[model samples]
Target: MIRTERIDLEPAFVLHSRRYRETSLLIEAFGHDSGRLAVVARGALRPKSRMRGLLQPFIPLLISWRGRGELATLTAAEAQGEIVPTQGSATLIGFYVNELLLHFLHRHDPEPDLFETYRRTLQRIALEEDPEPSLRIFEKRLLQATGYALQLEREAKSGARIVPDARYIYRPDSGPEPWDPRRHSGAGISGETLLALSEERLSKRDTLREAKQLMRRVIFAHSGEKTLISRNLWRRRRSSDAA
Candidate 1:
């Protein structure tokens, strides 16, 4: 006889949660070994449910669950330890990270490496580190693990190595191609920026800014036509900060 797989006290982080029915919650959790999962935390909405406090984004949790359906039933949950608090821009950045996983990751797909990266990114953000670099690195890793790797190291047209002195435009389907100065009006970037991104070396402020624009375009093109709510909210916060 085959035994059903049951998880008990797994390390996880709540990515997002919503009210389900009258006294429960529909939770999207990122497990260390199980990747992304959707769970129903029964009675979690009650006035004194322990799960109510534990099921929060950016906090490390120890969660127990069972069953083999698309949505598992959460049995128990508790905070693993104290988590550093985030405020202002860091809070928005945390939400953005959660949204990225909820929107892009598929159910039941096991990605242990990505899970570790997520944990580290959150910790970094909580420490008030610059979120841009961490976000960029996570986005690149997510894309690569999900088979949407951006070919930034070479030219798409002639299979030649990208030269730092030239300029190029990144096409979602075809990687980067030489930028035609006379034809294109916008969306092209310097080869130096692309190279910097490929090397994961965004130390220069100009390179980081250019790389942000390029990745935004690439992510938008590949994410189809659906508007990313988190990205929009992030932009609004950024605008408010500027103002």
Candidate 2:
């Protein structure tokens, strides 16, 4: 496949960045049009490098780049609009989303819709008092966008729409299965919870809690070997807060 050079002022988010050589940076970013990309920011570590500050995660950017193959050179990056600010726990959750993008999304694959969804989620997280709802929604959408959408409304075996009051088990290899009253098991979850998650609506506190449990299992099943560092960090933070 022939790789193209020179992408101009593309809308993007910095997924991750690290030092490359003396003063350059290797940037992994999510571009609206170009998909996930690996970019090299020349002299980004210098004291006068304007892009160094702009390349941080969660900031919207319009950027230009050149070069081809596995990596491209970042030529210019301009901050777009006011940066949405996330504080404390919200900040941690925001990083969690970034970690998911880096792990789940394929490089050079265009998922413009998911990219836009991420932007909006950050914006909502900034204004919302509780980040849990946004986190739940993001996890659900991320899985769906990556082709791991759950069978939320129906059973894989019986092909029946989920009954809100009924108990069920979401098998990782299969999907949601209605629990038989005769055989009690641990995988059972509430159909009401499944419906709420499928519709991306968490009206009650229990719904939020259940949604987290569901997302954790789903994400863990498909995440391969990539560990969720943000989740671990958040767990530690919560423990410390509780202590």
Candidate 3:
């Protein structure tokens, strides 16, 4: 007899969903213990299907699936909590967060702490006026969990504590080092911004800006050629508002 795997009521979120064939749907889900997985939700697109409304992003869900190999069959899904109130730009920010996870996390790798971070970040984005801090912090944590942890509090080579007033070049993979005119080509960040990020107290206007730039550079450097659609949408929104 062949073996099979079955998961029941695993805490998860729907990262994405697309129509499969005529009535079924292909779903990408991120579970607290299961990491990222793909499942086929048979007949989920039908008018009377219970999952049509339940399988949406930013909604806390209890998902069940069964099968063998990379793709599984979705057996059941239920709401674990109320839908996250992500309106206006917060919705776009939530997508950006999901994109980051899709880009950084490998399938089948269990990251319970990162899952908690993702959940908390969504809650923070829904509640906070400035969602940048939450995004930056989430990016930082994701990087750490994926093994590219930022070296924020100390000099990369000299090993000295970061000075709040000094300007440094933040190298992807290598952390921050003293700026050198000809040697440094990485993102320029202030020591204060680095410190604020290290402490997870990113609130000040300047700190937020610097943190945004630093995280973007680092994420793109590691994520390779994949362009984040959510980020592009953000740029377009900013451009439209300016015009």
Candidate 4:
């Protein structure tokens, strides 16, 4: 008897891609069941290849691939449904989400929770809602799922309940620490901000700012030394929008 590889039509989103040889592409995709996978799209760079357009980021897709190595061969790909196109800041934010997954998530790791968060985040972005809140929520969930859960409800050192009026510093490894006035000037955040984050309320401007700082520190610690291009572009866009 001969053994044959199975081809699956899985719901997926493109996380990242790079040119493979001259006329093909290597794509990293996140699927509902198969999780993150690297698939090679042969002749994808050809002008007539339908895969060229179907593999873009933020679009839901039904993809069929074969083989079972670290990299699979793309057999067929099709757009799943109507995608509301995003532009301006929304578009950049979508790319930023993709970049985060591409950089942080391990290939072949199945994270259904993360997948659901990504889908919802894209939908929120498509509707032109405040991307910051949605992005931050997803970021928090992603960090939690990946074992870097942010302990916002208690003190890191004492494991005591967080005081809503006191100031605390978030230690990446140990959770929240009571702020020392003389040693650390800026790391300490209001307890109210921590409480707001615990409640997922991004409407408070101060809390949002502090949450951004905390998340940036956590992401930087885990993402190694390479900088995300999408983050740079998003920063430029934000500055231009402010001006």
Write candidate 2's Cα lDDT for 150-198 as tens digits: 8898898889999999889888667888787678566578999999988
Q: Write the per-residue lDDT of candidate 4 for residues 1-243, one digit (tens) a residue.
A: 544355677889988888989999899999987788889999988999988877888889989988766878999999888774778778888888888887778877899878988998998887856677788888888888777788889888788999888998887777888899898877588788787877788887778888888888878887885688998997888788899
Q: What lDDT would candidate 2 get against the real structure?
A: 0.88
Question: Which portions of model 1 show Cα errors greater than 4 Å?
Answer: 1-4, 241-243
- Model 1 residue 26 CA deviation in Å: 0.5
For all predicted structures, in order, the TM-scores are 0.93, 0.95, 0.95, 0.91
lDDT, candidate 1, 1-243, per-residue tens: 644568999999999999999999999999988889989999998988887777888888989998776888999998888774878778888888888787778888998899888888888887846778777888888877777888888999899998888889888878988998788778588889988887888788888888888777777877775678887887887898899
Error of 3 at 14 (Å): 0.5
Name the regions of candidate 2 deviating beyond 4 angstroms: 1-3, 181-184
Best by lDDT: 3
RMSD of each: 1.9, 1.6, 1.6, 2.2
Location of the lowest summed lDDT over 10 successive residues in candidate 4: 1-10
Instruction: Supply the global lDDT for candidate 4.
Output: 0.84
